[model samples]
Target: MIISHKNILVSGKHQKSIVTDVFYTNEIVQKPVVIFCHGYKGFKDWGAWDLVANAFAKAGFFFVKFNFSYNGGTVEQPIDFSDLDAFGHNNYIKELDDVESVLDWITTTHTEYTDFIDTTKITLIGHSRGGGIVLIKAAEDARVQKLITWASVSDYKNRFPKGADFEKWENSGVYYVKNGRTKQEMPHYFQFYTSFIENKERLTISRAAKKIKIPHLIIHGSEDPTVSIEEAQKLHAWNRNSHMLIVKEADHVFGTKHPWSQQYLPNALQKIITESVSFAIF
Candidate 1:
């Protein structure tokens, strides 16, 4: 049977705790670890991600998913937009640091996982914004053995506002992006924009993709509305060694929606999970 643990807190940036969940079998053999990073306005427990974690666990991987320290989710409640203030203060750099903290907890003194996981064989999977962060991290961190991105954004600069909107955000110090599902106004502080500018070179997905020597997989939908399919092609163009898979007629989330009560993984998600498991193990 597979063992799963949730709400496990690890220390991360800004003196905040990173809430996480780990899924793995209690088998004696060492299993490769898969660390998943969620996208913007996302938490660890959103949608059918628990099922995604289970799918990875069943596929012989010690799957892990965590909220960024500033992801607005607390240890008591690791879902939804609970703390918008923490969410607003968040930046890509902090997200990178948070992922590293999870890595550190898994590979080192975290005794609960050390015996069952092969920390050296860590693979990272990110969706949308998180995917871009993974590319940047995998390029710099030697511990990451493989990488996969689902409908990932190609660049950080393009996501931010431009012209007057940009000027207003800079002057006001924050901008609110309405959450379609929650109907809450989510804040993206100007520091978010400033962070991108400060670390422009390091945060560039194309630059990082070209530098990645290990295996990489790009999974995206042909009709993704949130992020175009061209982003995937651009990533592939930079990293010629990487493989790209486009799901026909798939949208951004591949039909997986929040509040998903289904017992099984969606067809699109299942395909990528199977493919990701294969890619990570190979």
Candidate 2:
């Protein structure tokens, strides 16, 4: 297995955006491709991801995981919240564009896996918020053959606080949410809401899921606090063809943190990978 990390410059809202990718290459030609998108406040190099990528590569798949362009990480610093400005400016539409750009890169620019990856056989795997983005993308893009979401949110509108004065928020221009662990106040500009409202028709997960005619898998932890298992059920319910799997006792992040310590796989995460592998291959 040959694993390499590279920086990619992607076209974005204003200027070129930098994204990092972890590519797993094998000698075999025309292998199925698994493109992974990280969750909110997550990076490609987050805990256990390297091991997960290796696992997929070992399973005879060409795996690629990348950072969303505005995921708060820069080319110089690929981990942690070093660029809050970028994070603040991020929105769902931009993420969808980023994924499209990555797909374009995979189809046109990247040469290392040119012969190894079958662009038509691409599968997208998204974790948490990334899952919502993938669902939207898969519905619109015909290139995606399979879709998988782990602990994903069914609705993007639910992310914002309810019963708020829209006029005040529009006037204030920004709202802040406290990151309990980091103790940092993350700001959401009014543009975020405006963007969603403008793209509401295109961003609806249920709407997208209903249009998806390909294989779809929804996996979530029964004990997930961040995104309840019910949300997973909702996603499955939206798509008649989707398969839903709930881990017995796993919580959000599958019992892993930003700085995960254990060298071995957590039972819950291992189960997710195993199930996903089966879904992707079958």
TM, every model = 0.98, 0.94
C-alpha lDDT of candidate 2 relative to the true structure = 0.84
Q: State the lDDT of candidate 1 residue by residue for 1-282, as single tens digits.
A: 999998988888679999989999878778999999999888888889999999899889999999988988777778887899989999999999998888888888678677788988999999999999999999999999999999999998887899999899999999999999999998999999888899999988888999999999999998899999999999999999999999988889887999999998888888888888889994
- Which candidate has the top score in TM-score? 1
Q: Which stretches in model 1 have alpha-carbon errors above 4 Å?
A: none
Lowest summed lDDT window (length 10), candidate 2: 7-16
For candidate 2, write residues 26-138 as lDDT tens digits. Answer: 57667788999999888888998877887787777888887887887887787777878878888998899988988888778778667787877899999999999999999
